[model samples]
Target: MSYEEILLETEEKMEKAATVFSDELKGIRTGRATPGLIENIRADYYGSPTPLKQMASISVPEPRMLVVKPFDVSVIKSIEKAILKSDLGMTPNSDGKILRLQVPALSEERRKQIVNQVKDLAEKAKISIRNIRRDSNRQADQLEKKSEISEDDCKSLKDEIQELTKKFEDKVNEYFDKKQKEILEK
Candidate 1:
């Protein structure tokens, strides 16, 4: 394959790495209520475990409140139990039809802990991006050794891959900064 095609593929992989990191960040909790918090919750519905969103309609009734109205009223109890059992540290209040979850204010220590967690996640994302760059660089080196691509062309491709890596790393840092600010905000 041509150097151009190889660079294009590398860029696509880098973009995918960034997307995965963004999805992971969404799963991290903030002080405010967001529908994404429960979107990943798995509930036992009709003898099958499925995502909570598939079985209920989740809404942010207020900044700190999440309301889950289940399509099947019978699953209300199961939903409540699932949430209570989850790592979110939240208790669900159900009135035989819908479940209400009130997100509590984070303590100072809790906020710091969350910030640390966000930093850890950001570090992992950076590592993944770097891995992609390493793989692309290896491929470029192989092409250069095989003489399928000229030395100049291989160097240029490596430079482009490095730039892409830096761009994605910046994106990860930006996300981490925003999340850290959100966690530390009063």
Candidate 2:
């Protein structure tokens, strides 16, 4: 592949890694209620497992309360079961038509655990970014060996890849820090 293509692919992969990390961070509880925490839960809609967000309308009527009204009220029980099966510790209070989830305040110990989880996720994202850089560097070297690019060009490509890696790693760190502060302070 051309140098431009290699660089663009590397950058896209790094961006995807960062985006996934950000999405995961949204699921971590921050002593507040948010639709994101439960939107991805898989509920049995008919014979298929569907995301809760698609099966229902999840809203935060209050800072600490989530109201989930299923588009098909018949699926309320399945949604409740899904919520219970989720890793989230909260239980849903269900009526015949809708469900209410009470977002409890995070205890100090729980907050610490969540922060640690964030750290782990951030590390994983950095690792992904590094892997993409390695692949891009290898491709550049191959291009150099084939005489498709000069030695200096390969070196420049590797340097550019390294810079992209650093930029993405910093972005992941920034997301982690912001999440950590939110979890600990709230």
Candidate 3:
């Protein structure tokens, strides 16, 4: 592939990696109620493990309350069970027709722990971005060795890949900072 193609592919891959990292970060709970918190819950619906959002309408009834209204009332028990079993430490209260989840306030210790976890995730994303840059560099080097591209062209391609890596890393850090602020806020 040409230098331009390699750079574009690397940029695209880095962007995807950053996006996935951000999505995972959103799943981490803060001191508020957010749909993302329970969107990943897998409830046994018709013998199939499906996401809660797929089977119910989730809404933030209040700053700390999440209300889930299942289209099928029969699945209420299943959804409650799924939520109770999750590591989110949230309790689900079902009243025949709907489920209510109250997000507990985070303790100072818990907030610190979560901040550390977010930092670890950010580090992982940075490492992955660096790995992509390394792979792109390797491909450019191979192209240069094969006489498919000049040394100067290879250097230019590597520079572009490095820039892309930096951009993605910055995005990851920005996401982590925002999450940290959310977690730390009382």
lDDT of each: 0.89, 0.94, 0.93
lDDT of 3 by residue, 27-97 (tens): 89999999999988899999899999899999997999999999999889999999998889999987899
lDDT, candidate 2, 9-120, per-residue tens: 9999999999999999988889889999999999999999999999999999999999999999999999999999997888999889999999989899999999999999
Q: Write the per-residue lDDT of candidate 1 for residues 1-186, one digit (tens) a residue.
A: 679887898889888878887888777788999998888889899899988999999999899999999998988988998898888988888788899999998999999998899898889888988898998899899999999999999999999999999998999898889888887887
1 or 2, greater by lDDT: 2
Model 1, backbone clash pairs (residues 3+ apart or across chains), number: 0
For model 3, the run of ten residues with the poorest summed lDDT: 86-95
TM-score of every candidate: 0.96, 0.98, 0.98
Task: Judge candidate 2 against the unseen true structure and give its global Cα lDDT, from 0 to 1.
Answer: 0.94
Highest-scoring model, lDDT: 2
Report the error of model 2 at residue 129, Å.
0.4
lDDT of 1 at 31: 92
